[model samples]
Target: MFEFSLRQVALCGQQPWEEPGELAEPPSDLAAVIGTNGDQFRDSFTRLCLYLARTYDDAPQTRTDDTVVIGTEYGNTEALTRLQLGALADGKMLSAKHFPNATSSSASAFVNIGIGATGRNLTLNAGLLTPVIAIWQALYALAADRSSTSKVLVGDVYSAEALLDAKREANGLRCRSGLTHATFVKGREFRADFDFTADHEAVVTLGAQIGSDKSIDRNGAFVTADFLDVIQKLDVGEQSVLTCRGPLARRGALTVTRQNFDTVGNGGLGE
Candidate 1:
């Protein structure tokens, strides 16, 4: 069991998703770019971090000790073995060789732009959120054991080539191409709350409901923008149940809520 609270949430991304015909395809060099391809990844990743900074005014600092990072890392080639690729992805931050050049590089910008730094940096990566949470729980417990205070930062980045790569696979599993970064810090101010638990039943029921109705929510919700509005409606004490695939072919659930904040008046918020 693990729990926390979030007083602030910020998000940024390309909007309206220009029509396919409206945009030119990525260059061939960028096709199937891996995280190990330092230059390409850093350029894209830096732009993402910049967008986050503009939206939240909180740029990423080069902290390698006190922060825990969790995310997905798909490989650049189909020949990459699942075990090998997973290992490669998981070990991204450790290999200085994969880091972009210090001169005229995005990674350099990311390192130089941030003002806050900490000492507990750690990186944990996974293909999905469940494992990310599980890893966070374990690592967080270890941090507590050591009597250390740390924050958890989660992020994910995907490219069009990665999505196309998946479509060519036999399983044809779903894929998303985007960048996401979230910050988690410990505090008791502003009266916020969050909860996560395993609930297999809710996962199945929700999947059925979505499938049968052919919609995620009653408002025919689809796309990231549409979903963002749904999230805004969440209020203190109102729980949001989430389901995800766990390790070794298992199912898991997580429940989230805002506690101690009033959402009844003042436009879905409490004081």
Candidate 2:
């Protein structure tokens, strides 16, 4: 019923993956750690936006009137990694520029920047229900008739620079590289070239979880994405379950549910 996109690290040469849409190109200095926390943060967002642009073919003209919803377990750890120097800098633990982006909403800021959108911004605490809650809330905003075209950017980001042993003593778990996931949802209109046939079903459910955030991709002809804290991949038959933990890189899960009717046209997306 839904499609998924994911990014993560691996213990064995990493898992084989392909960024189906615009994310095929790798990020600048992504493999190498350079620049300030805000720079890295912006870079991460830029990479995601480039991928989204390519996948959805969005132009710079995309306005902010739409909405961007983002989530993260930790934010702007890079900025927090700044070293305190001299008596004046001793107390300033985090960078000022990166301070605004220090929350879970940073990803949404990147989405708006990449698409050149002037839309509503919504950020929330990290938990199992965060992304799903965001999806539902975005839908509600539209159902409540706030806007005609709404875009939901759901994902997470963490501080890579904050991984140092010394900083671990200072900030604890805040600096670890967390997961990043996002997708676009439109109101009342489906994109083109999307066809569902018997071949489209998936079986094994791919999963990613951290803190309260989680995502699962169910496989087979009948498939759906479950954004729950504990998403156990369903086995070949119903009830049977298999599980695998994902890496600490950019991760995402997406799904597209469709419905068809033989009669005058009344139906729901079959799960």
Candidate 3:
């Protein structure tokens, strides 16, 4: 079992077709760190990342060694779609700025750069299971190095265009345009575990143990966001667990317990 601590959590949900004018401008410090004028990208995915990254930077608990992990179903598809359409229309490439943003990892890369984290950085895609899996990977990275005190920023983002494409491609399956972020540090108060099994019974048994009242069934794109909500509501000495079952029969479980800060050692919960 891997144990960790929750340092901070931030979530942003964009209304369908939300206008760029309504979005908040990125802070000057954040814009400087990200090397953007805060109006360079009109895509919801990058804008959401900048918003969350600003929150992370403003938090006092943030560390320089913190690792960044992002998961997405469809990443910056708007940039790619626009690139394709522009090229097809005139047989000429679109603006060079959109080229780098076309990749799935671009948003996370922006976060990593903005935050100045030198630790492991990764971006994962696992359909609906992306967020939970990203959380699992973050915990594992912390566990891999016991002396490391860095927190992990695990996040997920889906652009408006990506959500639209997902809805149309998945037989009208429900999809949301939003982003979620949570920072975790290694600790002895929480347990993070993962399992791989094709049997539905295994997931049911684990899910039941985690407690149905606290359990969040994999329903939509906001699984991680919902989990973060539960984590933030936990009181000191209280604990809660959430389990997610992936399409490939992979199960990830996270149990978070808010412990008294006085009880924590000077090393900051790495014990």
Candidate 4:
């Protein structure tokens, strides 16, 4: 019922570090810039928030009163890996570390670290629809008069091995490890449609067409058809529609970016 548009989007990936490539040194004060790392998910998650905070800091379009909603499907994996290897020594860990080279400071606070105290919220296991869901959540809140202004943050992180394993195990398919983010703002219009086939397969449309122009831009190769099919498998008897106007949702529709692994879905891509 609420309409919205994406304001900004920032995404990160572990594959760049996994494979050989030139890299930039992050500020030594990364701990200060972004909150200290808790684990892979938290660190990568923090980086996402940090990038948005820094990039949009002085933008006239963004405000201190904006709201935030974070969506992720990798929360379980993040929590699981953190518990399994949070304190393990170098060789004992599953892969290369992506956080700061120092210990975390318990005294540190995330109170306005990036997006500020704009009533940020989080949603886990939000599926591929996370980014949009986050935007919708913020807009819905505003429409209900729950908040004066809203800004949304949505991101996801994955482990190389575990990501591929889950994909294969789920449906004998393969996937890669990557993280994504999307920030949204209030918009002027919205639309949606849904129906069921005679055979009862649910079909739905979020917008009249995919917004390839207004989406977060990225480079990579992925299976578009597979993703479309995956989305339709929402449930046995449910269908929904969603549509939006504005620069964010009307341009490039949300896409799968950062294809850091192979299509085999097997463990051949990375360690």
Per residue, candidate 4 scores C-alpha lDDT tens digits across 1-271 of 4443333334344343343111133335546655555434454444544554455334434436555454444433434455356557444554435332222210012323344544544443334344444455666676676655554444334445345444443322223333333333444322212221222224422222232322221111111212222223334233233222222223213321221222221111101
The best candidate in terms of lDDT:
3
In candidate 2, what are the lDDT values of residues 69-145, reduced to their tens digit? 55433333333333322224665545565445554345566656656666666665433234444555455545555
lDDT of 3 by residue, 9-73 (tens): 65555344543222343334544544445344435566556556656534434546666777665
* By lDDT: ranked, best first: 3, 4, 2, 1
Error of 1 at 260 (Å): 0.6
Query: Any runs in candidate 3 off by more than 4 Å, and if so which?
Result: 14-42, 57-63, 93-99, 146-161, 168-173, 201-221, 232-239, 246-250, 255-271
Candidate 4: worst 10 consecutive residues by lDDT?
Answer: 217-226
Better of 1 and 3 by lDDT: 3
- Each model's number of backbone clashes? 10, 24, 0, 16
Identify the runs in model 4 with alpha carbons over 4 angstroms from their true place: 13-32, 35-41, 57-64, 86-114, 170-180, 187-199, 202-271
Candidate 1 deviant stretches above 4 angstroms: 14-41, 50-68, 75-115, 130-156, 168-174, 188-236, 246-248, 262-271
Please state every model's RMSD to the true fold in angstroms.
9.7, 12.4, 6.3, 13.5
- Give the Cα error of residue 15 in candidate 4, in Å: 8.4
Best candidate (score: TM-score)? 3
lDDT of each: 0.34, 0.34, 0.54, 0.37
Q: List the residue pairs that clash in candidate 1.
A: 65-119, 65-120, 65-121, 66-119, 66-120, 66-121, 67-120, 67-121, 262-269, 262-270
Candidate rank order under TM-score = 3, 1, 4, 2
